[model samples]
Target: MWRNTELVRGLTLSLALLLAACAGAPQRSADPQQAESPRPAATQAAPPELPKSSSESPGAEPALAETPMHADGLEPSADTAANGSSPPMDFWAGLRSELQFTRCADEDTQSRHWTKRYAGYPQRFQQTIEQIAPLMQYVAAELRAADLPVDFVFLPIVESTYFPHRSRGERPAGIWQLMPQTARGYGAPMKPQYDGRLDYAQATHAAITLLTHLRVQFNDDWKLVNMAFNAGEYRVKNALKGSKGSRLPEPRGLSPITIEHYAKLRSLGCLIDQPERFNLQLPIIDDTRALASVELPEAWPIEFLAHLLVIDPQELKKLNPGLFGTHTPGFPGYRLMVPARAKDDLIAGLAPLPTAVSARWQRVALADPEQQRTLVLQSGLEWDLFTSINRQGGERVWLPTGTGVPKPVALSEPAGETYRVRQGDTLWHIAKRYRLRVQQLVDWNGLGKRALIKPGQWLRLRAPE
Candidate 1:
């Protein structure tokens, strides 16, 4: 019994030693490279990082108390609050922080028209927010990406109330509310069928660029910049010459125009601060997956293209507000904002559409080419289109002379033509004149996008493929 006990004790002792050795053993590295290059303990043991809080991150929102309660008491879904994880750059919250145009102070009814009325501002705000949901995010993104204040985003609301392609029978148009000259300066094409000023994506970029320039020029004083934007920099600077350098002490000495602009912006800012406090059930405005911008070589009918892309036609129209009508003009490398969900489908469908199915061409008939006649173009219908098609003209035809049309013709063009570049001409003007696409001009001339064609420059006008 003593011998058996001794043997058992020895076996137990050996097992204990083996277990302790196993517990203390250094593990081998799974990666051979890691084994050769020993990493520091901190590096190997570091945990995956969690997302930072608002206070810790750039492009983040201020605390909830500093701003109005976002999402209007509801939890966030696809709805965007100014600077959250939502789509379009957390528009409201972001703009709220960037606001220097006004203080959310009490009634200055004498100077501000918005304050005199009922709570129409919130209602209008809600309406516009809802109206511009899918598109708003894109514009907001541009502002944020440019590092411009969210306050400038609201200027569009003041200007056009978030409606793209809105014209006030005045000079300015589009969501950013840029004037024709400003729009042209910022690369907004003034084509008859399609105005780039109405283009949400293009106009947003241009607007941000213009605003950034104004901000830089005015030494980052947004109020003065906005005032300048509304009532021209020249006028704003002229008004400031009477001031204490870029800032007015009070409403006492400012021009009426500057004051009104300041007052209107401030009024809107005040109302926007506490929309929920006023009982407005504003939606969360984020829609990150709303629209995707696709580059196009030529024009395509919005409805038809949407159908081809397997998306909602109206949704495409809303995304592409600057198309002005049924089709986007065939400009060279035109950016088409389509439904984000349909991007893959659109790209897949764009593999050289058939001649019968090509959106570029439309049927037009010659009504006895002997009489003086003309074609008042619809949207996307280029005047230079005649050179691309088989024209059987035996008589002189004057444009804008009431060219009566009620005939069916083949879509195929028998030949092409050319034109000399004249002063005060553009690809849009040339394309409009020749009824050919800007893309066609680019392809034929082998020019870059929006390349400068000097006076007396030879350009193809529907000259054969």
Candidate 2:
């Protein structure tokens, strides 16, 4: 009985020890697949990084604020800084980064359609791009500063093909293709003397203003905004109101023209987004701001301004197409778009120059029997200034046998006296006659390379002292 009792005690003690050992040991899971295998502390996984929202992300297309135009007319707004990403390398890349609508699968298909069409005529496409490179740079900078979608730069692309002075008979004008009433409503200078629709700077501002207003009216739906931009806003509003059963208006609700315009916007945007997809490389346009607006105290002849700035007169005309005829109107605060490099020089020239007095012009009848004869001035100057002042550069200018020609009646005197150029006089001959270098004569009068001396035109014998 004593031995059995001791054996039972030992057995009980061993059983208790075994149970404790089992309790302290890590238990194996019933299903090995379902086991919770903990990794080392250092090897633990981290939470995934979240993508940024559109508003917070750099290069995201945000709602544009309705800001006033720059205090200096025609100045490009500074670029918005990129946060947490590398900066864009060029203008097209910068523009592509901000594209939103053209990124999706549905939009990609639509945009790619246009890309294929444009790619068909690669040379024409390339020429058009080269032609509008500077304008595109300026417009892109302006759109970016306005906080507008960089895709808005393509508006001009689809509008007038970036023809700033596109003259269509009584239709919407300028690069933005603004209607006359719409242009005037938006405060674009729409006078008979100066058509602001032809002025890129004014038209861009007006178009941006109109677009902003439309965006608000359309509940920020760019598709509808673009539709309204093409067709009248009333048309879009009417379509939306009539579509009682549908959440959005059907494509059939809009006219084919408006629909096409919207498609064009999308397609052009898509082309810009994925040029490579269309088997074409994107053109490399410099991202630099290439244009500046200069407010002139007085209207200066674009020719004179071009000569002073040493730029092509045709380029100056192209930039300031709003100016009537060959000169800017004689009004205060007349603005001129000049190359950025020439802006400071123009401002400097304006500061030191004395206000020019209006010259008294008189009409003198020509006694030439030939109907197409070039009129000579009595002072031995050619009638070049007269024809220029009168804006007579057509192939055939018809004047009666005794038609009147305009000439300046008075001279300011002094400045080493003016010499009257004879019918056969040349710059070389005149320079030798005055004992002056040909360059001096050319410099004093702002003479061009031709140094064309017209019979009866006056020339300064000496430099202004």
Candidate 3:
């Protein structure tokens, strides 16, 4: 992954210089809804002064702490205190009182606001806790070995609510909410056949590298690291300089303006503030010890592996949310994580398939204007079995398990209009823009299982049916 340390250093230095130039500069607020409102112009005015405290903001309210105790099957109440604190007059307590006393209090309303206060708590706190409790041993172990602040691990709860493949905003993606540029900058390859950012191993490695770098740059300050993570290091540096002589002694005391900027910009800072309210001790996570490695075959389905381990595919997906789909398409092989004890079972299940001896051939048609019909020859036929039928002609074709000569699948059809991919293009978005389903575009283009597309590459979008 470290292609060239010197090149990386040069890029990093350039970014740092760019950040310095932006430091203390008035930041362009990302709130598009407020675009029509009168506001300070970017070049002529300075940023407004930081607010004194959370209370000074127009709708500011104090946070609360409550017991983390769970009730078997009953509706959640504030009475239980996991932290052993007496019911105090905190925001949580008040909310709990409202919940208990109000006649209209319901599970839906409570669930929606539960995460609003606590960053890492599950959205369906009761259900999620029950589900995650069994995996705590595994999660805690990883947390301990990583020596990372426990709260940071829970950040995913805020990012994807433990749901893998969740998409938000304009192309922000995966559990970590990484954008394409940032994800690529961190070593995720944007290629025609693979997106390393969605691969858990690759993503975890990238995340760790980024976190470590941020920690070093910010002098091991977790809050600043978190802020830099959300708003970009440049924005954080600018916020720091804007605070200047007024900078807080530490992150806990950072002014509301800085905290609000981070929260509003990235939608995470307020969530991170939860542990502080409850006085819960953040655990140190050790990633190495918690993750047990299992080798996977080329193009192995991760969902199948999760099933083999008898673990929730969603949970597995959560742990490794960077993968684009159920399978890892190509590259230096893949690794699947399992419980430490299930290593033997996984290994046995993945024993390589016997090699094929006889030659094989298949014919398929292209739906595009080319209406191309192709004849292909191969010793094994796994590609035709796994990939969709509509794909027939392309620069790249999926091959079977064992390597062999790939004879072109001959096509008989007329050529169609070609379209070039542009920046910010996605199969779904592109199909919609051109009035097609994700599958239609894939079939028309003869894309492989990997479905890798790149900017500037020409694709054949068929004429309307």
Largest TM-score belongs to which candidate?
2
Candidate 1 CA-lDDT value: 0.47
Per-residue accuracy of model 1 over 1-465 as CA lDDT, tens digit each: 000000000000000000000001122223211111111010010011221221221112111000011121112333344333223335566666666556466437732455333244444345435544555556656677888766555565545444442332324556565665566666566665567777777777667767877888788877777766655555455555633465554223434433544555566566556555555554565444466678775655565566556557655655565654556766654678766667777776655343223454333345653321234243232445433222334343222222222122222222224555544445654452243456778888888975788867877654444
On a 0 to 100 scale, what is the lDDT of residue 395 in model 2? 45
Tens-digit lDDT track of model 2 for 1-465? 000000000000000000000001112123211111110000001111221221221112211111111112122223321111233247777777888665524375544555555566544354345446567777877777776667778777655445442333334556676666667666465654467777777777778778777778877788877766765666566677644565445534654444545555676676667666665455454333378767664545556567556677756755766654545654444457777777897776545333452211223454543433444333333355335433434443322122122222122225236766544445654443233567788899998877567867888776767
**Candidate 3 wrongly placed segments (more than 4 Å):** 1-123, 132-140, 165-170, 187-202, 242-327, 332-334, 337-341, 348-465
Query: Which lDDT tens digits does candidate 3 get at residues 1-465?
Result: 011000000000000000000111122234311111111100111112221221233123212111111111111123332422342334233222322111122223332243353333332232333222323334333444566544444443333222223222324344354455555666554443345555445544455556667777788776677656654565455456534467545444333333432232122222223434434333222222244645453555454556455566655644453443445443444445555656776666445432231111122333553323232233233443424422434643323322223332222123224555644345643443233456767787888756678867777767445
Selected candidate, larger lDDT, 2 vs 3: 2
| Regions of model 2 farther than 4 Å from truth | 1-89, 104-109, 165-169, 243-252, 286-289, 296-298, 330-335, 351-465
Worst ten in a row by lDDT for model 1:
1-10
The Cα error of candidate 1 at residue 341, in Å, is 3.1
RMSD of each: 30.4, 32.9, 17.7
Rank all candidate structures by their lDDT, best first, as comma-separated numbers: 2, 1, 3
Per-model TM values vs. the true structure: 0.50, 0.54, 0.41
Cand. 3 Cα-lDDT? 0.38
